[model samples]
Target: MSDGFECFKHVGLALDPIHVGTGGARLGRVDLSIVRDPVTKIPKIPGSSLAGVHRAYVAMAEKKYPGCAGQGQPDTSGAGGHCCDPKCPVCTVFGFAKGKDSTTGFTGLAAFSDVHIQLFPVATREGPLWVTSPEQLRIAGLSIPEDANADAVYRKSTSSQPLNLGWLLLPVKALSEHSCIRDELNKLGVPKHILDRFGVVPDRLFSHVVNSNLEVRTSVSINPETGAAEEGALFTYEALPRATLLFWEVTCKNPKHFKIGNKDIEAANNKDKVHSLVKKAYPYLEHLGIGGMGTRGMGRLRVLEPNASSNHSSEIEQSDKDKSQEARH
Candidate 1:
């Protein structure tokens, strides 16, 4: 097997508040809470959730749903929803387990990473501002000013007035004129309006600020028989607010060296093929949404195109041109 793999970073803009629940109510301010990183205490979407949805959407896109969308549990005849054919894009990109034996399963060619918040929107006196931190910028592969630290808020706006992030008021410090943070943000496809009001807060306060500004809504269950609210049915939940920017990475392994059921996969002979196949499902993620509570207007995320230079940059440009030409028709 070759040790060749390519990793691609993707940025997404939330169109609706996203809520990936923790399965049950927590004894906190809200009855229902979203999953959070244990160390940072910051909310994040698990890679497993992303993988499951991406697999299903890819199957649907390839017109192979119901067969290549499940766990591939065999039936009486030992066949399953997964075709287990090496040539199948769905099965090749996302591995399958069949034959009721561990030896028959194949690990998938692509792996997903957890989605992390890049720019969190917070309500402030200056209007709705996107809040980020030095640590957050570093994680997104952006450079911060040499003098920038986690002690004060930094922004390009010359306003000397203190800013209120949620209920916390913080004094603003003018960002360095040489800082390339804005340019980097632009390359990531952040809206110009959002960048105009961007504010960088101390890393120590980022978690608190984000949690304080999260969208919380109260819900109640109605009695099926009487058209009345059920007793003790009122509850509250939190979600990552709309317009939040998030980042995630996908790693595609070279598929030329892998085989399934003694047959090599011809569809994904190159790593780019595997990456492109997985990206084809991104449109589904944008339209159909991710996370939970989709029917109630939540979890819609729009994946932005990568504008940075990379090995596949030319291919991406060509693809965009083709899309534009198709739209003109």
Candidate 2:
């Protein structure tokens, strides 16, 4: 809460993926990019991707926010290029650069971490399930029962067949209980009133197949002159599926003194302004979406904000109860 960039604020984020693409075209296997964890091979939302999208989205919403500096440069126009308003909200929050050396602009007051996957939605015979691993949960400062079953899948028959989780299939076996995952998540301050299907699966199964379940989309460009498909315009891409859960954190630092051009802005005021803007952006984000192909209905995310108040837990619990009742009927 103190200013001066001294404290790191961890803001938990839950992304309900509505088709988000962070990369396009791999050289060997995929035509377009499907960024994955190098070791686990599971799809991931990189920090760079989230940070770029966030900065762009914030800038676009405000009129005073500086536009592009150049074709491939952010500081192309030099010191004279930007509006350079000392009090400009966008300039102050996102940081601005100017002049040839560009040594003057204050580094951004906020830091964004890569949005890591907390849960992956999988289909099973019993119902919809949100699959995750104990290790994955632990990485986010959470702990799950070590002895809990990891390989849990639903099967229509006991014919020694594998379970099909969308594009990936595995041998049917005893699966972990959703209650175990739900309890741990609740303790970690997850809002139960939110998405109700989050569950836990074996880490091995999750890592092996979630990437294969990604949504692959094919696209082609049209030739304006003849109104025909362009000869070389066809391309294929992939995006995260709907209901994919992701997390990210933003740390706001209170600066001692920051410069917005020649004028000095107090550190406390700078921190306050950025935090305020973030709160305002929450509602707009659901409507606008983020990442690539937003116009095509990709990258719609909802953030669950945790309140420390006594009523917070009870409120979410009530919401969860209502959702369960509705589903029952």
Candidate 3:
């Protein structure tokens, strides 16, 4: 069941932005790329990033609630009041939980929380450029804030916004696989109730391996023996890596099914789209701690519809023609 690809190496973040009008900005998109090492630069996406982002956001919300201190009750005296402190392993690697300490009343969370461990590196030009672009803003839903100025300040209060992780993780879901990770999870003594809630059945992981065909053309001789060949090429399709296919399926296809920890997630669910799942289950999602601050926070994910884009391009182009013709008539 192992693809021999055990360790997760590189993490990526791609983003897309939604512009309300030609002049006004509205939405964004984020995509992730994974790499085994810094050299080969071959990127394979991971699912943990997506899951981690959602989990981080949820934990953040829990800590931000009034009278709420942290995940689990910790001692009254600590650098950061949050259960998952800046010094805590979780906050350092994934995200930080910051709050007022009741005991000594210190401000910072030691060495851990202070450092923002970007799931994707910003050292490279491509990485840094992507982070600040409208695309990233769209993916992070930064363009659509609770209130322009006020929300920006509020976001500053926390290490990240509720949507930060989800936006960053969008690209990683493509390569999620169940190999040693699952085995390790079982070994960790995670209770069945918690595991089942993840909907991560070993067999079901197979569904994660969806298929995508890519067409590539290469030069070849039809009759090499005779040294005479046709100068034409044929179109052939091949299946992309299983992880790549799965990433598109969840993020680009049925995005509402995305998961956070053991819970169901739909960071992409658009509340305004009548046909969207987020709109359909708005009430339930809200009750289950899935509420967003503004209507824009309503789980609407703006992704690249490669297939749809190609198929409808001409149809849309012709529509413009039809409008012009009608005006003349």
In angstroms, the error of model 1 at 239 is: 0.4
Model 2 agreement with the true structure over 172-191: per-residue lDDT tens digits: 54323344445545654565
Between 2 and 3, whose lDDT is larger?
A: 2
**Best lDDT among the predictions, by candidate number:** 1
- Taken over the whole model, the C-alpha lDDT of each candidate is 0.83, 0.58, 0.25
Flag regions of model 3 displaced more than 4 Å: 1-13, 16-41, 60-314, 323-329
Q: Over the stretch 1-329, how does candidate 1's per-residue lDDT look in tens digits?
A: 34688887888999999999999988999999999999989889999988999999999999888788887777888766677777888988988875454367888899999899999998887688888887788778887665556466688776778888888888788888323676677678776567667778777889999988999988889999999999999999999999999988888999877887677787698988999999988889899999888988998899988655532324444665898899999
- The number of clashing residue pairs in each candidate reads 1, 14, 28
Alpha-carbon RMSD to native, per candidate: 6.5, 5.2, 25.3
Model 1, poorest ten-residue lDDT window? 308-317
Ranking by TM-score: 1, 2, 3
Worst 10 residues of 3 by lDDT: 109-118
For all predicted structures, in order, the TM-scores are: 0.88, 0.72, 0.21
Q: What is the alpha-carbon RMSD of candidate 2 to the true structure?
A: 5.2
Collision pairs in model 1: 67-81
Instruction: Give the C-alpha lDDT of model 3.
Output: 0.25
